[model samples]
Target: RFNQFFSFFSRIDTLGLNNFIDPRGYVQIQQIMENMTINRLEIRVDSLYMDLQIQILGLCRKNNIRNVVITVNPGGMIDQFRNKLCTESEFGVTLDVCERIGNVEGAYFGQWRRFWNEMDVYLRKKGIKMQMNLCNDNGFDHDGYARCGVRSHIRCERMDRQNMGVIRPISLSRGFLPK
Candidate 1:
């Protein structure tokens, strides 16, 4: 049934998967990705294991998939893990930190602050570009505020962006003033 479900399809521009967790999540997601040939893949970073995320990236590389987009929900202690995504991978990186009206475990200002600031420090050295609220949320309703976070992804292939772009990421030291 599964093979037949995807057999006819040869390719897709993007494959988006959400709500990934340990119990039985990675296996199912792994199967789908292995089965389908996708141009770009989007994984919603709700509450997934860090290792599983790396495994998924490895699978994409093995398949020669081009892009892997990670839309991180605001409430995770992912600064350290995200550092791995940026420096260790042999690919360019982009980050978009979203600010919402309410606080949650994974999607709050502190995690956002930690991740973004760390990236900034790395950016000065690696010269990777970062953007904020760069993606449109596809009209999905969100908690507290209706913000569709920005889009940035890992690449299996090489890219040459040339220079830094977009406004600098938010900084608490300077004091945040939301418009």
Candidate 2:
């Protein structure tokens, strides 16, 4: 039934599907990618397993998928698992996957700071320019923020704007404030 529907919707650029198989049947996904002319793929997975994400990412890379959207519930602590899984994969694959996935564009590392650190280093090594937001309430300081820049640091609302008045704005070369 799905194959028939997929065939009928051959001209579509976006595809929406739900995963019911355990570990997410990759062969079926490969088949769909091969058969469809999809440019954007949205998937809803039952589990937030890192391996599953990696598998899907790999497939997307192989097919040159331009955009990927995934929905997962925040249940267990999968940060460490995700980091390890990504670490084991090829950097080219991971970087390409990250670039193709639009949702990861502005993703900061507020919770999993350590994972963000390793990921940042890996990304830099691969020459992948990506931003990470890593300064929420994760109970530990990973120091990854400092590695990025002082401005990249996450501060409380009280601290963020406290010294705003002390800093002077540079005058423009045009003499006027330009506004």
Best by lDDT: 1
Measured on C-alpha atoms, candidate 2 has an lDDT of 0.39
Question: Per-residue lDDT of 1-179 in model 1, one digit per residue for the tens?
Answer: 76567767767665656545453555555565465666655555554356765666565654455555554543432435545554433454332223333345332433444665565556545645443332233432232123333222212111245433323323121222111
Whole-model lDDT per candidate: 0.44, 0.39
lDDT per residue as tens, model 2, 1-179: 66766666544455555653344576676676564555655554444466665666555555655444433322322345334434323332221111111122233322345655675565446444333322243432334322322112211111122232221111112221100
TM-score of 1: 0.56
Once fitted onto the true fold, the runs of candidate 2 whose alpha carbons sit more than 4 angstroms away are 8-11, 18-21, 75-111, 134-179
Backbone clash tally (model 2): 4
lDDT of 1: 0.44
The ten-residue window of minimal lDDT in model 2 covers 93-102
TM-score of each: 0.56, 0.47
